[model samples]
Target: MDIDVFAATHAQEWKRLDELVRRRRSLAGEEVDELVDLYQRVSTHLSVVRSAGQDPNLVARLSALVARARSAVTGAHSSSWSEVSGFFTRTFPGTLYRLRWWWIGASAGTLLVAFLAGAWVVLDPEVLNAMQTPEAMRQYVEHDFANYYAENPGTSFSAQVWTNNAWVAAQAIVFGVFLALPTIAVLAMNGAGIGSSAGMMIVHGRGEEFFSLILPHGFLELTAVFVAGGVGLKLGWTIIEPGDRPRLRALGEEARAAMAVALGLVVVLFVSGLVEGLVTGNMVRGRIATPVGLGIGFFVEVLFLAYVYTVGKRAYRKGETGDIRNTPEAVPVAG
Candidate 1:
C-alpha cells in the first residue's frame, strides 16, 4: 500500500477513534457503539500498515492510537464495584447453588466418615487405646483440646485460623486439577481428626466441653471446607466428563468458577475465625458465650444459603457460568 494514499484514506477514521478514546467518559450510547466500530476498523488499519508501510512514524502513530482506543473501548464498560457486585450476586453464589449436589455429597460423605470413626472408637476399647495411651488421651481431653483455643491472643488466633483455613481452601481448588485426589484426602483427613477428637473427649466424659468449643466456629468453618472440597472435586470431574464442550475448555471454565469460590471463602472463613478466637476461647460470665457464637455462625450460614437460593437461582436461570467475561480476542472459544 502506498503510505501517503493509505494515511490520507484512513485519517478521518483514526481521528474519530482518537476522539472516542479521549471522550469515552461522556459518550452517548450510539457514540459508544460508533467508538467500538471505529476501534475495530483502526485495529485492522494498523495491521495493514505494519504489514505494508515502511514509514516508521505512521506505524507508530497508528499503533499508539489502537492501543489507547482498545483500552478505552474495553475499560469503559467495567468498574471495580461492578466486578464485586457481579461476583457476590452471580459468580460466587450462582456457582455454589448450581453445584449444590456436589457439596451436599461432600458434606454427607465427610460427616458419615467422621461418625463412623467416632463410633468405632467409642464402641471398641481397643481402637481408642491403640490410638493413644490413656494418660495422653486424658490430657488431651481435659486440657489440651480446650487450651488450644485460648493459648493465643484472640486477635492473633483469629488471624491464624483465617489464614490457615483460607490456605486449605485455596489448596483444595488448585490441587483439584489432579483428579481431585488431594481434595478427597484433605476432606477425609479433617473428618478423621474431628471424629477421633470427639471420640476421645466423649469417652473421657468431656464431650460437652468438646462440642462447646468446636461448634462455635466449626459449623461454618467445616461447611466452607466442604464447599471448597466440593468445588475442587467438581472441577476434577470435568476431566472425566467434558460434556458437549472440549476437555480443556471445560476444565478452564470450572477452574475459573472454582476460583470465585476460593475468593469468596476468604470472607466466610474470616467470620469463622472471629468466632473461634473471640467466643470459643473467651467466655462471658454466664457461660453462654460459646453458644452465642455458634448462633452467630449459624445465622451467617443461613443468610448465605438464603442469598444463594434466591440470587443464585436467578443467575443460574439466566445462564451465568461464573467465569470472568472473556477478552475481545477470546469470543470465538466455544465455552
Candidate 2:
C-alpha cells in the first residue's frame, strides 16, 4: 500500500468527519447517516495507516479523529431498567454488607449512650428534674405520651411519622459530609429522646403502656436510624481517612453509598410508621396487635441483615460498589 497515495485519497473524508463532529447542533437525517458512514471509513483508514507504516503523527491524528467520530455517531448511551434492577439486587445490598462494620460500631455507641441516659434519668431524681418540671413531667408521662399515638387518624399519623423520619435520615446522610459531627449529634439526640421517654413512662408506672406503644414500631424505626447513622459516620470517616486513595476520591465513593442507604431507609421508616399508627393507635386489641407488629419489625430487620451477609457479601466480593453501572468510566473506589 502506497502510504502517501492512500493519505491523499482519504484526507478529504477525514476532513469531512472533523467538520461534521465540530458542528454543535443537531444534524440532519442525511448528515447523521453520513456521520456513521464516515466514522466507519475513518476507522478503517487509521488501521491502514498504522499497518502501512505511515507517518506516526498522521496515524495518531487519524486515530484520535476516528475515536471522536465514532463517539459522535454512536451518541451517549442511556441506562436501562435492568441496571436499576441490578442495583437493588446486587449493588445496594452488597455495599451494605461491606460497610456493615462501620454502622455496627455507630449503633453500639448510640445504644450505649441511650441506655446510660435512660438509667441516669430513672435512678437519679435530679436528672429528671433537670429535663422538666414535676407537673410537666407528670403530664407528659400520664397523658401526652399515650395521647400522641391517637391524636390523629392512623393514616395521617403514619404519613407524618414516615416523612419526619425520612427527613431525619436525609439529614444524617447529608450532614455526614462534614466530618460526621452532625450525624453523631443527631444520633445522640434521637437516642436521648427514646431513653427519656421510656424512663419517664416507667417512673410513672405506665411501663406496660409504653411497651405496647413503642415496641410495635420502635425496633424497626430505631434500626433504620442506626443504619443511616452508621453509613453517614462511614462517609465522614472516609473523608478524614481515605487510606491509600485520595481524600476526595474516597469521599465521593462513600457519599454515593451513604445516599443509597438514605434512600433505602425511606421505605423502612414508612413501614415502621405504619406499624406505629395502626397497632399503637388501635385501642381495641392493641396489646395483642403490638407484639405482633414488633415481631414483624424484628423479622424485617433480621432478613435485611441476613441478605446483606449472604447476597451482599457475594456481590461485594465480585466488585460491586453500589455506585451504579458507571463501568467503562473510571470509577474511584475508596478501598
Candidate 3:
C-alpha cells in the first residue's frame, strides 16, 4: 500500500494515540500504556509502508504524529514521565531482553569455547593432548587463553562481536530463513562441544574434578549457551522458511523473540563466571566433592532449561480458543 494511503486511513488511530500521550493527566496508567502500544503498532506499520517505498504523504503523516508525540512527552504533560517509565518497564525493556538472547548465545558460545580452551591447559592436559596435542595445549595455556582472558575481563564486548559475525554469515546462507539447517547445525555443534568436553572429563580422572571446577559457573553458562543456540536456530529457520509472511518480514518477527532468548543467555554466563571465579575458585577440595558439586549443578541446569525452553506455559491459539496470545502462538509476542 502507498504510504500516504496507509497513513491517511490510520490517521485517526494515530491521533488518538497522540491525544492519550498529550492528555496523560486525564488518563490512567493502564490507559496510557494501551495507547502507547497502539501508537507503536501504528509506527511499525508506517515503517513497513515506508520500507515498501517512500510515500511523501505517508511520511508527512507519520512525521506529524511523531512530532506530536514528542511534543507531548517534552511539553508540560507531566504524565509523560510515567508513560516513559511504563514504556521502559512494559515495552522497551522487553524488546531489549528479547534481543539479548541472540547476544547471550553469541557471547556464551565464545566464552564457552574460551573457557574450554583454558580448561584444556590446567584442568585436563590429557584430554587436550588427546584432542590436539601437548604442544597445542601449551600454546593455548601459555598464550591464547591466558592472554585473551587477561585482556577481556568481562567477556561481554568481545563475545558480542563474534556472535554478530556468526549471525551475519549465517544470515547469508539463510536469507531470513526460519529454523534453517544451518541454525540447527550451530546449535548441535555447541551442544556437542559441551557434551564432549563434559564427557571427556568424566572419562578421565579429571571428570570428577571438572564438575567442581566448572559447576559453579557451568550451571548458568551451559544453560545460557543452549538457550541462545535454540533462539539462533529459531531465527535461522524463520529466515529460511517464513511461512505466510515474506521472508524478511518473518525474520524480523522471529528476531525479536530470538534476541530475547540471547539476552537471558548473557545474564546466565556473566553470573556463572562470577560463581566459578569466586565460589568455586578458592575451594581446592577433593575429586569426589567436585563431581558431586557438578552433578548437582547439572541437575539444576537441566531442570531449569526444561522449564524455560521446553515445557513452559504456552500462548493461546487462533480460532481454537481464547487468549492464544498467552499460548505458544503468542509466545514470541510476549518475548
| Clashing residue pairs found in predicted model 2 | none
The segments of candidate 3 whose C-alpha lies over 4 angstroms from its true place after superposition are 2-130, 134-182, 284-335
What TM-score should be assigned to candidate 2? Answer: 0.74
Per-residue lDDT tens digits for candidate 3, residues 81-195, read 8864543233333433433455455556555664565455446656556775657644543445323322433345335434543454344223325445565555546545655
Error of 2 at 20 (Å): 9.5
Task: Report, for every candidate in turn, its global Cα lDDT versus the true structure.
Answer: 0.81, 0.77, 0.49
Check candidate 1 and list the clashing pairs: none
Cα distance off (Å), candidate 1, residue 332: 8.0
Top-lDDT candidate index: 1
Cα lDDT tens digits, model 2, 51-93, are: 4443545655776787667667677633688766676777778
| lDDT (10s digit) by residue, model 1, range 1-335 | 47688799889988888988899999999999999999888777766654552554565577678777877887844568997988888888888888888988988988988998888888999999999888887788777888888889888999999999999888877778899999899888888888988988888888887787788788889989999999989988988887876576577668778988899999989988987888787752234565676687678778777888899889988887776443222212111
Order candidates by lDDT, high to low.
1, 2, 3
Model 3: worst 10 consecutive residues (lDDT sum) = 316-325
TM-score of each: 0.77, 0.74, 0.47
Q: Which numbered prediction scores highest in TM-score against the true structure?
A: 1
For model 1 the TM-score comes to 0.77
